[model samples]
Target: METDIVGVSEHRFDGGLLAATRRFEAAADVTREVGAGSVGVAHTLIALARMPGGVAAGLFARQGIPPDVLAAGLPGGGAGQASDAGAPRLGRLPVTAGLRAAFDAAAATARVDERVLLIALLARLEAGAVDLLAGYGRVDLDAWLTEVKAGRRVGDVFGPDGAIDPAAFGPGASRVLAVTVTEAGALGHERYGIALLLHALATTPGGLLEQAYLFLRRDVRALREQTLTLAGSRPRAGRGPAPERAPVPDEPVRQVL
Candidate 1:
């Protein structure tokens, strides 16, 4: 519950948390522009839905979000005009107690497993979080929130089994890390957040989640190339192509009668 110098509660600003914070700020800007005069979950979802076709947007589309709905929800002023030149408008968008609690919980859960950051965002229903999730077909939002409230172990939001080891980020997750760094670099940011992770999941080297995207885009070659690239980078352990299997010493062809 300790607030940082900026007056917001302290949380892990390393990876996805940083990203979510930035998006929250942007959401507040949108709220201001739309004359809502306060930041809330509705603004956050609308901001996320406007990711311009990346893993972030794909996250929503997978849940059957219609483009028209997003269009209807977008804040109407000139989008993407928020700049870093002046001091941040943080004073205008005060972080509520609910949001601070969510941040604290996300930080604690993320310590065990960073991937569950999304779940933290979903756990709190205030600010249109549940409504946004329902838009993405989260029929079990109540159950999920309950589990989070009960202090369940952090794991994949969509996984059916027990908790997965957070340290064991899959191939897709590694790609997400790389892409996130790349995105932060592009933005001249020293750190990254969930937005970049979402973008990465929507684009290059997506694991299972990309299946739907590939089906829609029909870009199998890119996926194949990505797989090959990861496979190729693996250590051979002093093994060299299995010695080409010695060409199997072809037997002389028997003359067919």
Candidate 2:
């Protein structure tokens, strides 16, 4: 992909997930605040650290570099630093080549999300940013990235513990489930089952499950085959009236967000 200079709002992502878009917006804000000529990976990292309620912020917190401390160490702020009152405000600055390359790297993933973007940004961090981050603490970049890729399942929706937790299903997961249920109904199944769930996951383009498969270097076809075999072995509950046949939708389930 060509790494052309592009406006932050105009940059495109593979999945077009809202979280990814918001992160870029935050990076743009950071770039403007620092009066940089263009947005860079460093600016995005700073944005991720300062932005609350995201995976990056949580990771930074784990590394003992909370938002306030990170901000204090940056150029604009900290003890004994001159105020940035006269900082120039540039309009619609384009993203730097390194930043664009980071986005391109993240886009190469099965699904682009905050976790993937953060890893890409960190991988492409400039030496100055690395030094700046090193001042905060001993930041093991590799270990931090491993944690990002191995996402937390504290309240995973797919698990039994989080099955009944309303908060577990975010917009993305909710869309996947909605498609799964619709496909199940179309198949004349009285209740949702593992096979249908797996089918939905394999078919849903740009979903989290697909991303996992890619990250693990596994094939989606293998998952589908396993699901089918498992379903075939399970005996049906007590005989019930046969469900009426319905045509499956021609188009695969797609997540719009």
Candidate 3:
């Protein structure tokens, strides 16, 4: 059996044959964004927990919640300084209850579609901001996809004007796409080594996913061919060697959704 390594973030997760965990995590993260948890789920949960009108700190005395977390009329007005800047409007709600209310408001707007909020949150996570509460989007795919898929009309998601701007696309989108492809395609399949190559090809889009699908179909075919070859099966006498390979022409397809 062959062994291989797969890298994610900054390091590698290695395994024999197929490497599964990290790819699952990456896709899970996107799925979380697409319909699961928004990036702010942690904070949101905390906020929601405070809905009963109590502090988050006192819940588990043994856990030692921070005392500075009291609700603020707005972020940064009180104890939220401990919260990270990238935390969604976290710094804004001094009290846990208020912070939760903010989450409720966002959720209401999100139509409770966790995936939409998650992707938007991922975009914000990518960008390092939460300002997701107010009007005007996070101004990126993470935000747009979250809002659009949730229920906000794509037009509303994109804004009053209709435009497809690369500037509007976040680098995080590429990160999301690349990571998703790697996980779904080949990373370390015993039958096929799918690493960066799969990541690159499948995500290249426009039937590449199709090509990848065909390749998998070919995998089954390969098994059959290999079995027949081992069984002494032979091609017909008239069937000649495969023709010389030729460069395929290029064609563009519709933009990625």
Candidate 4:
């Protein structure tokens, strides 16, 4: 799988992989803007660093090598040029064998995301761009990768009101919450309950809750069924005893019907 980069074409473009695809396209555009014959590790790094809302961008920012600085330091000095509307499309150029290998390895893992792609690219860093990046600052790739993977813990998803925002967490948490919110909304629920959260934990991939299930050797499918059953049960909030009421004085018990 690591030998054939073309094999990535065969994989489904699910939500996660789709985001990875956009990163690759951005890298290709950077290659063209820099007048490189093909997409190299440097171009890929620049693209990742420039990507909006990407974990890689945040990591690069933390390392003091912002996207503009990285682009200016690299060859061709095409800082901010890739965003040109007339820039050549990614399909017009070829990708380096090293980058192809990285893509192949990332795809082989069957868990493609920004974090996974960033790790793959950094692992294959070569001499030219690696030296330039190091000159900027001591780029601690391992620490950055750790931050990308586990920056937002599951506990951090809860807000001050003790409600889970779902969007507060990282990609793994977002995936889980996406399913939970969709399923709850389909059932005409205004708020997702604990049972939906459990179901999401059983179904979502690459999350801490899923790891817990694997560590405990528990049956996720069975747990999903149990949680779905719980969804059907009435909420416990309004199930308490009726409130006390004062007795009414005897008046006319007239039935005007």
Q: Which candidate is the best by TM-score?
A: 4
Q: What tens-digit string does per-residue lDDT give for candidate 1 at 174-253? A: 45555544544444344334434445555554344466666687765665446434323233353334221111101110
lDDT of 2 by residue, 1-257 (tens): 43322322323443423553453566667666665656667777777666444566666766777654544455532111112333211235556666766767876776565677788987887665666677556788777778677765543423342122222333344455666655555445545555666776776776757778998998877876676455332334533444453322221211111
Q: Could you estimate the TM-score for every candidate? A: 0.40, 0.49, 0.22, 0.53
lDDT of 1 at 84: 31
- The TM-score that candidate 2 achieves is 0.49
CA lDDT for candidate 3? 0.29
Error of 1 at 56 (Å): 6.2
Can you tell me which runs of candidate 1 are displaced by over 4 Å?
1-11, 16-23, 45-59, 66-91, 110-115, 127-139, 143-257
Kindly provide the TM-score of model 3 when superposed on the true structure, using C-alpha atoms: 0.22
Give the better candidate number (1 or 4) by lDDT. 4
Residue-wise lDDT of candidate 4 within 1-257, one digit each (tens)?
42222346534223443453463577777766766766666677677667544566666765777766665666543222222333333555666666666667777666665566677788776565666767656886666657665655654445554444433333454566667765565454555566776787777764556667788998677877788667653444533332232111111201100
Question: lDDT per residue, candidate 3, 147-209, as tens digits?
Answer: 434543323222232222212222233333344333323222111122332333333433235
List the global CA lDDT of all models.
0.43, 0.55, 0.29, 0.57
Name the runs in model 3 displaced over 4 angstroms.
Answer: 1-95, 106-172, 178-253
Residue pairs with colliding backbones in model 1 are 19-193, 41-127, 55-202
Total backbone collisions for each predicted model = 3, 0, 18, 0
Q: Is candidate 1 or candidate 4 better by TM-score?
A: 4
